[model samples]
Target: MNKRNFLVTGASLAAVALLSTACSTTGGASGDPAAQRAAIDSAVESSLARLFQENSNAKELVASAKGVLVFPNFVSAGFIVGGASGTGALRKGGKSTAHFRMTEASVGLLAGAQSQGVFILFMTQEALNSFEASRGWTAGVDGSITFVNVGAGVNVSTQTAQQPIIGFALTNGGLMGNLSLNGSKISPLTFN
Candidate 1:
């Protein structure tokens, strides 16, 4: 085979391998609805604790938010073609109202894997209602999400907090940088 052809073939194989591993690790539970619910609940609890600790203002946001979508562990891995997936629960008034899954695909200058917890706060009742009404909600297009940067202290003023939606992404440990949730799609999941 020619050198160019050989290189392309090798790249394709590597991409496939990376995607397979990512899927297996991040895929939601396939059986046992009770067990899956337990896991998601635990993750949401721990993740929210961490967020509240890191960003004190998050407490206020959570209290004021009409609903919150928490993805405890979203994993992303790629080589050329990349995707991310995670399972989570939506909570209203401190109780889980529904389960949801987040998935996204991208092609760009990126490679490697990352695992992070994401919490999206729907600031307005209308925003939360619109999201719950949709069969599949795509980020950025459906609504603009502002990712709060906690590094600068908890200064999320009332004006900024008034945005329709806000998000926070936290990584446990990984080589990934500049996390983006632009094209991610979130849909409700019914566990059987």
Candidate 2:
């Protein structure tokens, strides 16, 4: 190849790399901690309102919430079929501290990562005890927790909801893989 052509190609590759790096860093810092919290709060409020308007169960879900925690980013993965989850939280504030985590295995043409998801940990002594005490709890098995899809408008009414549960609405980060293979990891909770 000619010297001029080689130089142009090199510059083009460099530009592409720089652009890729920038896009990868888009959600970094998410902004000031306080601002992010407020952002989460606002997003949750708006999302829940929309959910409530569309689904009566969502209204009851909000009514049933004592306290809510909107993670705005919960990561997941499988293999071929993968997507991120992002949303808000609902909880009743009375505990000194709270902790929760979820891990899953899936089959089918599954692959990639759910890099963004919201985990609503219902803050209550009863729920806390159940989660902490149990070794494992599936989404629709042991408890009455509900997950609101970013697009799917669905919820369980408080009258039907056995116990107050935390709710989450994940909105961003759909392309992701496993943490061990792709260096992804779960983020910890941020208190107010």
Candidate 3:
């Protein structure tokens, strides 16, 4: 096989293995559909509560946002090529309007394994509407997300607050450092 094909195959295999391990540990998203939805909802609630407690700014953002999407866990592993997938819910008017699955893959000088929670806030009705209307929304192509670096004692800046869409990555310790959702894809997750 050519070098490019070899690398692509390797990356695909690595991503599948990593995601499988993650799902198994986190009550795998297979099996009962009701169970999977419950798991996602439970994680979203806990993660959002923790985020709000740690940073009041996030709570305020949620209060004002047209929609809020939260992914409670994303297991990421990579060696040159990497991928991450997580289940989450979209909240409108403080209730889950829909469930979504988010996945992202990248190829670059990257290597590591980590898990994190992600929050995306749509500050405008237009943005939220567009996101919901899409069959499958891909970051940076379908729409752009302004990523905010979050950490202990970190404050959301005024400029960041004004963005149409904002995203944050958080871990057990606290919010992860700089990260992006550039190539991430979001799709509706229907429960069977």
Candidate 4:
């Protein structure tokens, strides 16, 4: 086989493997529902604490927001073709109102795997209501989510805080860089 063809084939196989793994483990639907909820809750709490510690601006944004949707462990892996999936809980008034799962697929020159925590804040009641009422909410299609780059020593701008919907991606080291929520689908999860 030609070198280019061989490289393409290998990358395709790797992408498929990564996608299947993401589907199987995201949200842990195969396991007990209560346990899954508990795990997600714990992760969410820890992630929030970390966010607040890293960026003081986050606490204010979260406090004023109508609801917070947190995905503590969002995994993305790709070698050319790539996909990402994660489960999260929607919190209203500091309580878990419901659980949701998010998934996205892309085709581009991308390679690597990353696990990070993602937070989406609904700054307006209308935005939060529309999300909750939808059967399935897509990031760009349902509503635009403005992803903020809240890295160390960087403060969120007042304009970003005023947006109807805002998002942040956090890693163990600190905030992640260049997050995109476009074309991602979020669906309500009902545990059996």
Candidate 5:
């Protein structure tokens, strides 16, 4: 290869390496559990701030919800082979309600990325019942929700936000996620 071509190849490789490193680094962890936990705390603060801004019956849900969980950064990867997992917490009345795990997996067709999103689970009997009785849930399945960009949801204010469509009537394809939040211990998030 010519000198110029060699230099170009080296530069490209370096760029890819930096990008890969950034992709894998979530919540600003210094490769330490404590740092990651700190990142999680910050993410939760942002989630709550989002909660105040978004008017999605989140208030009503929180009012009656058994708890609210905020996942500031949930990362996953997949392609020929796939497995995913992330950490988040449950909050009640602006406090740490509980900690929960979220995961997804599949075989054959796939897409991979390190991503961040929000999850609102209603624990109260009424809220849970409403979720169950809903006719359908669409993450963008039928346009009930709008995604300004691929994999991005508009922030939920009083109403409307981009969506990842985790659940709803229109959620289709992909491996169904396993969510076990029932009766899970919850600790309210403390902003102070």
Candidate 6:
């Protein structure tokens, strides 16, 4: 196929994949407030455990964070017009205080699907309150978010961890580099 044809075909396929996945995943249990909350809770627990295992210092970060938003299973699939969506919980004092959903759309040179976990730690009470107060929060636009890269034997010091907001993207499957939250928007999910 020609270059133009190839690009068009790829974009079409990606859109189809994204729509199908969203429809299937966002239906039934996802529509159920209780079920969705349970899923998000489970995801947050598992993601936190993994983070703690990778870097013990994360435990301290979590403990100190005023609130943490954990999206355990964020799935992103795209060709050129890519989009991602996931549900997560906001935890304070080790308890889920609210639920939220993160969504983003992008148009660029990209393809394939990826499943990953994302954790955003609000290090300050002000930051946490701002996020909660916002009707819709867009990362990188609404507020500056620093991405934390944790490697072997690496530690996040108290000073370094003092950022107002810190984000971690954990790749679980598929392409890792293809996922990002630059334009992602997070909003509260009402369960009723």
* Candidate lDDT (C-alpha), each: 0.79, 0.43, 0.83, 0.87, 0.44, 0.77
Q: Give each model a TM-score.
A: 0.86, 0.44, 0.86, 0.90, 0.46, 0.85
Best by lDDT: 4
List clashing residue pairs in candidate 1.
Answer: none
Candidate 3 RMSD to the real structure: 2.8
lDDT score at residue 46, model 2, on the 0-100 scale:
55
How would you encode candidate 1's per-residue C-alpha lDDT over 1-192 as one tens digit per residue? 999878655765676676566544324644788777877887898888887777777888898999999998887776666678888899999988888889888777767877798889999999998999899999989987887766425587667688899888877641122456888999887676
- Deviation of model 2 at 137, angstroms: 9.5
- Those runs of model 1 whose alpha carbons end farther than 4 Å from true positions after fitting are 1-30, 173-178
Q: Give me the runs in candidate 2 sitting further than 4 Å from their true place.
A: 1-30, 71-87, 93-108, 111-125, 128-160, 163-187, 190-192
Candidate 6, poorest ten consecutive residues by summed lDDT = 172-181
Q: Is candidate 2 or candidate 4 better by TM-score?
A: 4
Question: Candidate 4, residues 1-192: lDDT per residue as tens digits?
Answer: 999989977997898787677756635544788887887787889889999888888888999999999998888888888888888899999999898888888888889988889999999999999999999999999999898977767888899988999998997778874898899999987666
Clash tally for model 2: 36
> Candidate 3 residues 1-192, lDDT tens each?
999989877876886787767755334555687778777888899999998887778888889999999989877778777788887899999888788888888778777788888999999999999999999999899888888776656788999999999988888788764778888899988666
Could you tally the backbone clashes for each prediction?
0, 36, 0, 0, 25, 0
RMSD of each: 3.0, 10.0, 2.8, 2.2, 11.8, 3.3
Candidate whose TM-score is highest: 4
lDDT of 2 by residue, 1-192 (tens): 999878655654554443344322213436565554455555445545554454465455545555454443344443332333332333344222332333333334643444444435453557655544555444555555544433344433344354445444433432121222122122333533
By TM-score, how accurate is candidate 1? 0.86
